[model samples]
Structure formats: structure tokens, C-alpha cells
Target: MPTPSLPHKPITVSIVSHGQLSLIQPLLGQLDRWCTDSIEKVVLTINIPETDLLGGMRWSFPVERIENPAPKGFGANHNAAFTRCATPWFLVLNPDIRLDGDVLAPLILQAGADSGLLTPRILEPGKSAPEAHRALITPVEILTRNRPGYAAPSVPSWIPGLFMLFRSATYAQIHGFDERFFMYGEDFDICARTQLAGWKLEVAEKLLARHEAQRASHASRRHLYWHVTSLLKVWTSRAFWRYVLQHGGR
Candidate 1:
């Protein structure tokens, strides 16, 4: 738990885990090897309904686990943990992600300049880089592109929430992700809010991370219901409606 040797201000890396105990070690190992000197603290938010096993786990970096009720959605859990972050930069990582050595440093620098929110290029597990980050979300983008037959449309501002690095001040100013969004669309909502608040959202193409996309919640019907409901809520928001009306939804 030694302090990270950072060049500028220390950044706090916050990871949100539901029940991916198997992936936690490897993920932390990669972070320690890759981000050793860059990250100051690694805060793990564990959704523990009763017992707290995270406290007993071994991690290579300075780590702390905060136990809380199983959250309604991803955004809610992250919002809960956001209050405890005191760093200039905060990294929101999923448990199933492994970072490349140079991934976060450049993103942190970009965010420091003008980007309020920055997400790294995400690669599917065991694969090379793929085009995962994109522009803002629209109903048509969600319906048409996300389906099997349709192709994803071009966007100017969308980025995956799997590995988001944001300015702590900007995150606090925007009040973090909307808690109403249980899971899906929360990142989109936050991006939209960032634009509305006059903050820049950037995709750091050079930074890369491998994502397994595996999660306990993603396998359940209850989780699907919450995801759909939250997505609809974000799509139907006033800002999104205006974008839809003006741009034809995609």
C-alpha cells in the first residue's frame, strides 16, 4: 500500500465490483504493473448485501474497499463511491478490465487540459483493439446499431463507461451520474450532461484496455429490465429529445 509515484497530482482509481472475485486479482495485478507510479489510491466499491469478503483479499496497490448495499444500477453505485473520492482525477474502472501500461497517463493528461471526461479505447477480451468508443447516444443508435442486422452509426461524442477517467471537480459539479439510471445509458446521460454543462468529453484513442464484459448483473432478466428502463429514461430526456428531433435520432 505504498503511495504511487505520480508526476503531477495523484489520481485516485476507483473500481466498482459486484461479485467478480475471480477477475479482481488479475485486474489489480495489471493495474499495479501498468499504473504503479501514476495512481495514488485504488478504491474498490463492493456491492455487499451482507458479508464483506473484499477486506480479506490481497491487492498489489494501495486499496480500500467500501461495502454498501447492492445498488440498483451501475451509476448509483459509482455515485455513492464518488462522494469519497478526493483526488484531482478519478478513474472509474470495471472489475473485468485490464489496462495497458500507457493507457491512463495520457488520458489523465488530456482530461487535465480541456477534457472533463475521457474514456480509453476498449478491446474485447483476448482480442486486439476494436472501435468501441463513439459519439453521443440516440434512440436509433441504440435500437438500430445495437441489433444484429443493423450497423452502428457514426457519432461525435460517445465513449464506453467501462473505463472512464474524469475530473473530480467536474464530476462533483455535474453531481456524478444520474442515480435514476440503474445501468445502461448512464454513461450517455453523463456525456450529455457534460456537453450541456460546457465540459468537453474526449475519447483517448491511444489509451487502451481489455474488457471481458462479464458481470453478474448482465446475465439476469431483472438487470435487463432496469437497463432498458434507464436507457429509455435517458433517451426521452429533454436534451436527448431535442437531439432526436433535430438530427433524426441517429
Candidate 2:
């Protein structure tokens, strides 16, 4: 556990709400309570039109809202928000993520010169165990996931976008998430490119956050279609193969 560092506020958080303002409100409250000292401001993207519940609310840091004229994909929404970033750190946070304490301090303190992306251990609600980190993405890896004694790599090959904290320069160097990916596979794609560009993906294991999992693709046909198509795109991408060849798909 790290103490809150208030001398400098270096993080600019990016959160996109696809009509999940209810969830965003509470998440924003947690950030206000615990991370206000570390965060410069919050860039919230309202991907679809909704009631303006945040009109009179206040926080220690500024809350800049981007009301989209039309809905954009996950990468597009966050990429648009990045244009407003002026801090050293950029966080891509999910609306459902809840924090009990200051999670940003430890991550910021731990980031080395070569650290490109970092994340805290993500837990499901009421669970003590951390969520599984992902292995490298390939068609063969996907098809063989359920085989006997199959195991994901001990070191994560990719981090989910749900709670990625990026060095702003590293993100700019990698050119952010590929907009070609609409929703699902962009996380894996970005993580792969981040490592291929000679930067380390570090995890702050002592810090934790709870993710109230939405599991949207499970219930929505449209979302499921996007997930499948995005996986196909990742499997066919140059970045994926380059990572596999260079890193040996560890």
C-alpha cells in the first residue's frame, strides 16, 4: 500500500460511458475520494445521449465531458479523449471499476523509465482472487484454450483495457489503440504493440480494484458479433504475428 502523493497530479483518466452514467457516477466518486491527489482531471465521454445528471456535481479536479454527436467505438472514444490529455500518465478505466483505497500512488511510484503500461490487480466483486491475466492472442491459442493441462503464461502477454495506465509518451509513441478495432480486441492489440516497441508492461500487485463485470457480450447479440469479429481481426493483424515471432508467444 502506498500513501497518496499530492505534490504533483500526473494522471488524466479517460472513461467512456455507453449509457452507463449510473456506474460512472459511483466510480467517479471513488476516484474523487481516493485518487484526486494523483489525477489532474477526468475526461468523460458520453458515447450516447443521456440525462445530464452531472450538471451540479463537483470534485476536487475538473470533470471535462465530451458529449458525442453519435456513438463511437471504444478506441475512438478514448483516442478522442487523449487529445485533451496534458499529464504524464493516461488511465483508461471502466465505469464498473470500484476502488477501496488509493490505487494510483503505488503504480506511479513503481513505473520505471521503461514502463509503458501498468495495471492493478483486478478482482471480481466479493472475490479475493485476482482476475486471470491474458496470454498472447493467436488462432491456435484460442482454439486450444480448453485442452487438458492448458495454462496461461505466468507473465501476462497483454493487459485488458479495463484498467490500463499508460505513460502518455509511450501511448503517443505507439499511436494509441487501433481504431480499426471497434470494441473487444483493442486491448490485446494495444498491449502487444506496447511490448513490441520495447517497453515493459508492469503490474502493481499490492494494489487492487474490483470490477463489477458487465458481461455485455453474453446477453447482447450485437456485442457478441463485435467480439467475434474483433478476435478475427486481431488474429490476422501484423502486430499479433510480430509479437508472437519476437516474444515467442510466451
Candidate 3:
């Protein structure tokens, strides 16, 4: 991918929140400071009803809150919000993530470099480093951690979706994320689509974000079940098999 000069327009940041009002407030503050006038808009898609807590919030950037009554899956909600985004680039962030200014600079730099799809190094909250080199969206990686006898492969076949930056034009061309995938596989699906479309995906090693993993998702068995089912769906997809073969799957 050819590196393009930074566009004059601000990048839009979109976040999908279920019931994480407490965590999101602070995350928004951090984004306001780091983003400043560079944030074209901050849109939050909430499954819960609109409330005073949302109203009282103010940031250095413009923020918009949209109420999603049907409560579709993560990918669907993001795709729905993308329909309203007008920026040249858009970032999809989880509500529970805590980001630093230094991390944001590198990510934006990388995004400007590729102008396709960019992902940041995600760390477990409070951890000094990343949880792993890469994450494979397969049962093997999920079922076991890297150990003496059972070491998960360091390089993943797919990129995790927790924090992804996308070129709005390319995303629109590919129809954004596949709404069919309620959660897990959407990241892989998008990466696969980008690859198939001859676009490049880059990892911003210098940028980092701390994720409070699955606090809300683990609250219910249904979420876990959906995540598992979604993984299975990806494994069965023809595109996934092609991805595996092209990447020399284990």
C-alpha cells in the first residue's frame, strides 16, 4: 500500500456500547484530549435507552448518541452507524478500552500510511505489554494458551476486531462489515474481504489500547454461546478456508 499524506478532514470515531456507561465516560475523555479537532465526530451506538448520564457528558469533540432498540450484534450495529458517518476514515473502538495519546499518534500515522485497514496492539487492561503477538480466530487458540506442551501459534491467521481503523471508501465498497456475523468472525470477514479486494492490512505495533476483556459479554451464557457459534460459522465459510490455505494454516 502506498503511504498517503494525512488528509485535512478529521477522522470519525465510532463506538458500540451495550451497558458500559461507567467505562465509556473516561474513554471518551481520553479520546477528546488525544483527538482534539481531528475527530470529525464521535458516535456512540447504545442498546440501552437514552438517559441523563449520556446527556450530561461533554467532550472537546462533537459527540452523537444513537439509540438502537433492536439491539443487533456488534457488526450490525457498527454497519448501521457507518451508514451515518461521513468522514474519510472511521475507527471502531470497544467501549471498555483505555487509550493513551502516544498510542493514538502511531495508529493515526499508520492509518495515514496505509489508508486501508489498520489495527492497534491490544493489551489486557493494566498489563505492560500485549496479551499475544497475534490472535487466530480458531478453537485451537481459544482453547489453549501458549505453554511448554501446548503453544498457540504466535502469528495469527486473522486480525482481532476489538480495535480496527478503516478507510470509509474501501469499507463502503465492501459493504462495511458483514452483518450476518453477529460478533466474532466479523473481523476476520472484513480482513478477508480487504485482502480479496487487493487492499492492505497493517498492524500499528507502536499504538496500544488496553481492553477490559469480556466483562459484559461474560455476564451471560448467551454471549459466550454466540461467540462460539460465530467462530464455527467462520470456520465453515469458503473464504475462511481459502484464507487458511493461502496463509499456510497449521
Top-scoring candidate (lDDT) = 2
lDDT ranking of the models: 2, 3, 1
Q: TM-score of model 3 relative to the true fold?
A: 0.87
Q: Write the per-residue lDDT of candidate 1 for residues 1-250, one digit (tens) a residue.
A: 8743446535788787666656677788787777766777788877755344445665555787677754546787777777777778888888888766767776665554557887777788666657544545655565665567665444455566788788888898889988777677788778777766767777766666778876545699987787778778976787676555554644
Cα displacement (Å) at residue 247, model 1: 7.9
Number of the top candidate by TM-score?
A: 2
Candidate 3, superposed: residue stretches over 4 Å from native: 1-5, 112-115, 149-156, 216-219
* Worst lDDT 10-window in candidate 2: 1-10
Candidate 2 on 1-250: residue-level lDDT in tens? 8764534899999999998999999998999999888999999999999887777999999999999999999999999999999999999999999999999978988888899999998998767799766778767777886678778677889888899999999999999999999999999999999999999999887789999999999999999999999999998999989998998767
Q: Once model 1 is optimally superposed onto the true structure by TM-score, how far is the C-alpha of residue 156 displaced, in angstroms?
A: 3.8
What RMSD value applies to candidate 1? 4.5
TM-score of 2: 0.94
Ranking by TM-score: 2, 3, 1
Model 3, span 159-243: residue lDDT tens: 6777788888878888888878886778888887776666777777667778888654577788778777888888888777776
Output the lDDT of residue 105, model 1: 70
